[model samples]
Target: MYRLHKFLWELRRNPELAERFRSDPDQTMRDYGLNEEEIRAIKGKEFRKLYQAGANPYILLFGAVHMGVPRQEYYERMRSQS
Candidate 1:
């Protein structure tokens, strides 16, 4: 979880890394030590999975924003799951 947090943080702060993530999220997650499920969740843009896995909401928001998801759309998607 900590590693995922740090990995998200890096993706948020670094443009190059963010570009890499946008281009190939699975590979990026793999390079960052995320497990297959974690990689799948992120690569698939399954934020609900990440949240259920104990990811921080604030960071998840940042991730969603960084990935170009509209704020309202992200909120709606998350809300629908609850």
Candidate 2:
């Protein structure tokens, strides 16, 4: 969970890393040493699952944005999950 948060925060803060992530998310996540569950949640855009798993909402939102999810779509998905 700590590693997942660190990766999310880094994805939020670093443009180059964000670009790399946009290009090859699985590889980038693997490079970050994220577990399979973390990678699955992210790659599947399961923001609610991430939140339920203890990820910070702000970091998740920012990371989702960096990953090309529109704010509206993120919110809609979150709401639907609830």
Predictions in order: lDDT: 0.83, 0.89
Q: Could you tell me which residue pairs clash in candidate 2?
A: none
Instruction: Give the residue spans of candidate 1 off by over 4 A.
Output: none
Pick by lDDT: which candidate is best? 2
Q: Which ten residues in a row have the lowest lDDT in candidate 2?
A: 3-12
Per-residue C-alpha lDDT of model 2 across residues 1-82, encoded as one tens digit per residue:
8888888889878999989998998999999999998899899899998898888899899889878899999999888875
Q: How well does each candidate superpose onto the true structure, as a TM-score?
A: 0.87, 0.91
Give the top-scoring candidate (TM-score): 2
Cα lDDT of model 1 overall? 0.83
Clashes of 2: 0
Alpha-carbon error at 21 in model 2, in Å?
A: 0.7
Report the Cα lDDT for residue 59, model 2.
87
